[model samples]
Target chain A: MPNFFDLNVHAYPETDVPVEDMYRIAKRYGYTGIAITNHDDTEKGKEILPPSISTFVFRGVEIRTKSVSELKRKIKLHYGEVPLLAVHGGSEVINEAALKDSRVDILAHPCGEKGEGELSHVLVRYAAKNGVAIDFNLNAIIHSRRSDRARILWKMRENLKLVRKYKAPAIISSNARFIYDLRAPREMIALASLFGMKKDEAIHALSAIPEGVLEHKWKKKTEVEII
Target chain B: MKNAKCKVQKSKYQFVFYILHFALLLPPSLRERKRYLVFEVISEREIDKRELLEEIRDSIYSLYGDVGASESRIWLIDYDKKKDVGILRCAHNKVEEVRAALACIHSVNEARIGMRVIKIAGTIKGATRLIEKSV
Candidate 1:
């Protein structure tokens, strides 16, 4: 069976829910692993790794930048500081920049409220070549309803079509601020189908893509050479 | 009057027999195939059976529209309030649709909740067994 991984769970202090509780709940939900992602500005003091409860827990950072220069600066500063680096992407310039940066693992929420979409054919092509993954955040789907929900789904479908066309890496995540927001893996896969994703593709996004990113981090940290 | 009453009774008996014979001859393809989903509802407040059914229906109807909701054929088989575990029934082909709708649901009457699907079974008995083992 393919293992499931959630790549964008927010840690404590970012939300009142403790990070340990998030791991426990995620484990109970059958997630193979979870990455505790904290936003750059709020991440302060010594970041402590929560005790491992037999689930693979990785520390990550979400960087929000106003301009391309700021994005580059943050990636430069935070590279090697954390295993995973995600950029809060909504601005067109920022999205493009993040996609081209090999150091950036994920570009989160590229399509925000009032925004048409963040990825274009050109940007998606770059993302495919650069190995940057476009995030399909489920938070919008959970929070919106009626017309608002329809609009968000439309934007997501549009992005997904481009992602599939270009063969760019797509990562599906709850973008969950707390444990309650986390969804079961099978549930997420079914929801992904509404946006035209095949079951196998959704499974790849939830499992293989995130696993590959984590493996890259591990390799870098350990300086391992595989034969 | 006796003859007329005898004719009516004879016709009623034939009708009942014919209906039963036809049903027995019906092919499996003509029968409705059902799938049972065993799920646990995680929430802060206790939810009643009626409320749970209404909330799930409303979520599916809103997300997928009347046509999709009807096609899904959603029904509650069993619910345990204390355990917050339940088994739901739907068309076999529409299982994914039901799962998708359940995932979209985040709250019920201001109570935040999450649903986890533990098993999908072909029979109600199998689903009940799975629920017993899980719960």
Candidate 2:
């Protein structure tokens, strides 16, 4: 019942809260593990993580495309494997290109002119082929002003359909900026289901998908298993 | 919330909404449907987007019966150093024919061709009126 996963979390100079507090609050939500994913800055990720606490702390980054070459170069340059490396916002151009290479693990919040992180049937099919995980972002769901809810829901509903179609590679996250926003897996799953996600599908996203990505990033295929 | 979707009452409500939309449509034989408008301009500079959209919407309604906006899917595309508007389903017969029947034929030298289509929803008059005079 406590099974949970969070793919998008950050630590920056803008926020004064300490990193240990983030982990402590996640523990309150009963998270089995929490992946510390932030935007483009890897050193920041290296900075905040204190001695590994109770819940799993994953190191990752949300790579914003400086340019195509920069994207390829960064992927090749960062030898250290990150548990989650998401491309921020929803754009098909970035996802399609990033997913082609195994170096990229997650396509975080892909949005088109239509809005939302949506991959076409072609993309859904290709992501499965390349093993790039699709993100179902919860930050916008929880934080957006009510006026934008319908559009966000519309975009999320379309994405959920794709997640259902491509089950193995789906990932879900709070995309949290601050410690207070950290949500338990159940809470995230509940919101997901509210926006047309099936119950089992939401659960699978928080548990298996994030865990699987971590394993792949670590290249530790044989490590502990989840039922 | 997982079981919420499965509730019988929710499905019944969903069924009713679908039925209502279907009833509103005119069906193939009796329906006026819409015409697709493609405008080619002769402007050299990129026209202001809002200005261009307003011109296109007004043109469609002027020619095609109060053709407000049926369903507009506008894409501001730049190609061949030329910008064009493609209005898929406009109301009037005036904005008729395919390939080359564009009205308000302005300067061909610097203007880019544009087009817009209207897809009527609910009440055609009230629904299609998203097209404003200025843009």
Candidate 3:
């Protein structure tokens, strides 16, 4: 089995559940590792990694901001501080800004948590060039029903098309706040299928792409050193 | 003559029993192929079997609609409330579709829950064995 990683999970200060609880459950669910990417606004000061579980629980930040300039500053602030830098994407402007910057890692929920954002081919091409992986948060699909779920699936389908055309890296994350929100990797692949993602593509998104993102495989050497 | 009559009567009864068996149970070739999925659930509190089954059905209906739900042919074969694990059966070709529906269910009767399929098998016996090994 390939090593599966969930790069956008929230825990501790973001919610009531602690990192240890999330790590234990994620390990039980068969994940190779999980990144605790609490929202920057909610996080209190610098997060100290619990030494015991540090190997499997990666510390990351999900920058949630409105203005483009502030987003840029935050990216500059957190770039090399953490192993993963996820931008909470929504709105046309934020999507474009995040994708354009090569420093940004994964763009979590490009369509917004509620399926409110949009991405065009140009933005996707930028993501391709910048090596910013577009995240498809399956929680949106799992939580919504009826028309809301339909809309999210439709938006994801459109985004998937763009990602495919540009050959941009894509990742599927639970984006789970609580332990109950997590799903097994196979279930994630099945959920991805709901939005037109093929089996192989979903597997790659859940495993290979996230691993590459962790290793900064697509990042330029100079960009890495400058941080 | 008596032995021959007894043997003939026994043969006739055997033939009738075979016909009845075929009539009551579909022949293997004609039977619909099914897969058994052994799954585990983690929830806020104990969930009743009926409630969980209802939620599963509702999820399938809402996600796939009537026609698609019918094609899946979902059925709950066994559930151990204490263990929070169960065996569900569905059409062989519809496993993935059913899996998606199962994943869509985030709650049951207001109790938040998460579910995952542990293993899938072609027979209930195989699924049960998997459940044993996993537990």
Best-fitting candidate, scored by DockQ? 3
**Which stretches of model 1 miss by more than 4 angstroms?**
A44-47, A51-55, A113-116, A217-227, B1-30
The lDDT ranking, best first, is: 3, 1, 2
lDDT (C-alpha) at residue A6 in model 1: 92
**Which is the better candidate, 2 or 3, if ranked by lDDT?**
3
Query: Of models 1 and 2, which has the larger DockQ?
Result: 1
lDDT of 2: 0.57
Model no. 2, DockQ: 0.01
Q: Which tens-of-lDDT digit does each residue in A147-219 have in candidate 3?
A: 9999999999999999999999999999998889999999999999999999999999989999999998999
For model 3, residues B45-131, the per-residue Cα lDDT tens digits are 999899999999999999999999999999999999999999999999999999999999999988899999999999999999998
Could you give candidate 2's per-residue lDDT for residues A105-222 as a string of tens digits? 7878765323545567777776676677878776665544344655777887876787667653877787765664555565566567646776787888888778788777422432
Off by more than 4 A, model 3: A221-227, B1-19
List ranges where model 2 is wrong by over 4 Å.
A12-14, A41-48, A52-55, A79-81, A112-117, A217-227, B1-135
lDDT values, one for every candidate: 0.85, 0.57, 0.93
Model 1 chain A worst lDDT run, 10 consecutive residues: A218-227
**Candidate 2 docking category?**
incorrect
lDDT of 3 at B26: 72
Q: DockQ, in order, for the candidates?
A: 0.63, 0.01, 0.80
Q: Give the higher-TM-score candidate: 1 or 2.
A: 1
Q: Largest TM-score belongs to which candidate?
A: 3
